[model samples]
Target: MALLVAGAFFMEILDATIITPAIPLIATSLGVEPVDVNVAITAYLVTVAVLIPATGWMTDRFGIRPVFIAAIAVFTLASLGCAFSVSLPMLVAMRILQGIGGAMMVPVGRLAVLRYSDKADRVRAIALLTWPALAAPVIAPALGGAIATVGSWRWIFLVNIPIGVVGFLLALKLIRGGPASAARPLDWRGMLALGGGIAAALIALESVRVTGTNWWQVATGTAVAVVLLVLAVVHLLRTPHPLITLSVLRFRSLRITVTAGSLYRMVITAVPFLLPLQFQLVFGWTPLRAGLMVAALFVGNLTIKPATTPLMRRFGIKRVLLVNGVLSVLWFALLAVLHPGLPIWLIAVILYVSGALRSIGFTAYNTLAFADVVGDDLTHGNTLNASVQELASGVGIAVAALLISQLTPLVGGGPGAAYSATFLVLAALLAVTLIETLRLPRNAGAEVSGTRIRRRDR
Candidate 1:
């Protein structure tokens, strides 16, 4: 069951990143600017951000098995739609559908695993579940580049068909239907407000890059987003049952975790997106070589996973988070100093270390966030965390794109300037996590094993 959940997660994460290396090819085939084609990427991310808040309500109304199966089916079919898309708009639409499926697949699948897994094994269950998410980015670029170079870019999406089919079957066989809980009325009003707010904000962010910084269109989008967000906040405050329970924020550990997690993902997620472009466009490496270079990140992430549990047990979550958070920022900052004459192998080595440290830092922060929550709140907390993760990833990419676009002119409009400035900005963004992480109580994970034991008793 853990393997199935992880497999589903891996499939989603792999698809999320695999398209990046092929972005240039996709742009060329569709006769669009490379930056313009970012819409396809942003569209999927935005859709996930907007739809994620609805996952808990969906599971409650439909039951986990049905929802999980539907999500996989939708994602599988959407991949086919993406592969066959003939126009940029069409591709964007399909990706949006893909995001809808992905948004549901992860949270609901994890929910199933949590509900079914013995309480004593919850920590290990979560650690195991995260493996695919950790591994997906590692493999995505290399696999994407390999597929794009030797075959058509369409193969990336087509490749999911078989995996999705196997996942669907495994899910059906291994996943059992639990006793159906009473369905609650869907929060239509809250959903509209939250979804609208996220959609408007994302559109505004994307508009900044799409219409350029000075365009009135960007201002209009920003205004609309602000209005929608204000209304969403008001709606949530007044609603009896909000789409996202406002009370989750009241938990101190959870609050700190959410803030730290958002900032952490914001800084780290940008690396894979930025590095591949840098290696290929700035360093003049082939897509395959760039992909291989990016693979160093995965290697680093994998290498560090073995030590994560022991590190948390030894130094404690807060200390480990604070130290690693600062180190990860430093690692990203180092990229800004890389010169054209630097050795490629050295660059890979630096990236590998960054990836390892980042994985360790994020894993610690994520696990600690839920260290204090119990029972039903655990499910709510996990769902909220997942939504925030998606939101952060979307914001991270949009911000990176905007920064790169702004820096392009200042850096002399070449790949070198674009990547250097982007890396500097990413490093700074990551540094902000140090502040959030400091808010964690000194003994935040003090009862770590107790929390595991408690989950088992439930």
Candidate 2:
């Protein structure tokens, strides 16, 4: 069950990251500017963000097995459409459809694993599910670059078809159950407000990042997004059986996980977004070589997974997080000083350690988030977590882009200086996350992590 869920999660994440390296190639093939093709990426993230809130309801109203299978099928067919697209509009539309499928696939699949697994096994289950987050982003750039170098960019989307097909078949045969209990009514009004609000906010963020966008356009987007989001908050708070139960956030574990964990995630998420651009633009490395260099992070990520659970058990979640978070910030500080004159091996080593810290930090955050959540609330917590994660993925890219756009002129209009400035800013912001971790009770998450921290008062 963990493997199946993990595989589906990997497919969704891989699709999202694989396009970064191919964006320019894709734009050229479609007779558009590289910057314009960013719409394809933004469209997918926005779609997923908008649709994620309703995933729990959909799984319950429909059945988990059927919903899971259908999502995979939709994603696979959309991949075909994306591959055949000859124009920018066609590609963006197809990506939106793919996003819809992904929005359902990931949360529902995760819910299934969480519902069936015992608490004692949660660390292992979450570790399995979390691997895709680390593996996909690190591997995608190198794989996408190689594909672009040797063949057409269309292969990037086409590659998902086989993985999706296998996932769909396995899900159909292995998954159990028919329609789930729909005791609670669907919150249609809440869904509309939340989806529209999130979509608007993402669009506004993307608009702010674009250098060519007019000031008026960014202002309008920002205004509309804020109004809709405020309205959504009101609706969710007042509605009976809200689309998602906000009350779960009252728990300290979940509150910190979603809020501060998201801040940390943005920095980690920015790596794939920034590393490729920095290497290719600043160091004058080819896309393929830059991608291969990025793979060191992925190797480091995978190498550290088996140790994560044991480390948490021995050290406790809070201490582990604090140590890893500080290490991650320090690593980013090192990356801020990277130069073309630096040896490739040295750069690779830094990335390797960075990857290890990223994997450990995120795994700790994700596992601890659900430490206090149980039974019926698992669906709500998982849904909300998934939504925040999607939002972070989009916002992370937007933040990175906005920083570079703002810093480029200040740094004398060079790509290398702009990227260096962005890393430094990110490293500084990431320090705030460590402060947030400090707020965790000294013995926080000890129950779920299977470790005890000795307290001074005791």
Candidate 3:
């Protein structure tokens, strides 16, 4: 179950990351500006963010087997659509379809692993489940770059067809879970509020990043999103059978990890989005060269995984998070100072360390998220965590786009300075999460980490 789900999960993430290095190529092919191609990235993620709230309910209502099968089919077909798209809008439309499939596929797939594994094996189960997250980014840049340079960029999307087919066949043969649990009444009000709020806010952020969007439109979108989100919070709190159980936030471990992890994700997620663009646009590197360079980040990600479990066992979650968070922030800050002429080895080393820190930090966050969650509430906890991850990643891209666009005009610097300013902004955002890490109790998540920490007064 873990292997099957992880394979499907890798397809989703690989689809997401592989497109990063190809964004510039696609923009030129589609006759759009480089900045405008970012919409393709944001569109898919925003669709996922908006619809992810409904995943738990959908899986419950539809049964996991059929739903998972359908998600794979949709994602596979949509990949074809993306490959054949001749225009930006067509590509964006295909991406939205792809997002809907991903929104259903990822959380439901994880839920299967959670249901199958024992608590004693959960750390290992989640590690196996999440390995794709590490592996996909590793392969995406080099593969995507190679395809874009040697052939048409369309092959990037087309490559998913075989993987999706294999996943579907294996799922049918090996996945033999029971019927879905009794269905919960759909939370229509919460769904509308949260979905609309998130969509509007993301669109507003994207609009601000564009060159000629009206200021009033941005203000109105922002205001509407804020109001709708506040109302969504109120409605969820008061209603029975809320779409997502925010009440789970009462768990200190879950709350801190979600709150802090969302910030960390928002900042770190921007790197993949911005890093490729900077390499191609600012450094004047070819897509293949840029991707090979970015592979250093991938190398770092892969190298750190085997060490994660032992590190948590030795240092405890709180200490590991603090140290990793600090190093991650420092490396991100380092990006702001890099120039086109830097030696390749130094750049590779920087990217490698940054990726290692990211891998450690994310592993710690994913493990600790479930530390305090118990039976029956496990579904809700998984749903909430998945939604936050998607939403934060979407906003991260939007935030990077907006920062670059706005700072470009204000700083009176070229594209390099614009990218550097954006990196600093993301670094500052990530640094804020360090404060949250500091506030954690010494023994936080000790139950899961298997490390003992003596209590100390804060």
Question: Could you give the C-alpha RMSD of every candidate to the true structure, in order shown?
Answer: 4.2, 3.1, 2.6
- Tens digits of lDDT, candidate 1, 145-195: 999888888999999999999999988888765435775666688778777
Model 1 RMSD in Å is 4.2
Best-matching candidate per lDDT: 3
TM-score of each: 0.90, 0.89, 0.92
Which prediction has the highest TM-score against the true structure? 3
- Per-residue C-alpha lDDT of model 2 across residues 273-358, encoded as one tens digit per residue: 68877776678776688778888887888799889999998988888999998888888889899899998899999999888898
Comparing candidate 2 with candidate 3, which one achieves the higher lDDT? 3
A best-first ranking of the candidates according to their TM-score comes to: 3, 1, 2
What Cα-based lDDT does every candidate model obtain?
0.80, 0.82, 0.85
* Angstrom error at residue 88, model 2: 4.0
The runs of at least 3 residues in candidate 3 whose Cα sits more than 4 Å from the true structure, single-residue gaps closed, are 1-4, 112-130, 169-181, 455-458
Query: In model 1, what lDDT does residue 438 have?
Result: 70
TM-score of predicted structure 1: 0.90
Model 2 spans with C-alpha error above 4 angstroms: 1-7, 30-39, 87-89, 110-138, 165-176, 181-183, 209-212, 455-458
Report the C-alpha displacement of residue 154, candidate 2, in angstroms: 1.0
Candidate 3 lDDT, tens digit per residue, 1-458? 78889999999988888898888999999997777677788878878876787877787788777788888999999999999999998999999999989988887888788877899988998988877877788888988888998998999999899999999898898665555668878899998999888878876777774367878978988999999999999999999999888998888778877899998988888888888899999898888888888988979988988899899988888889999987887887899888889998999999998888888988999888988889877767877887888778878887887888888887666888988888888888888988888888777787888876655622
Report the poorest 10 consecutive residues by lDDT, candidate 1.
449-458
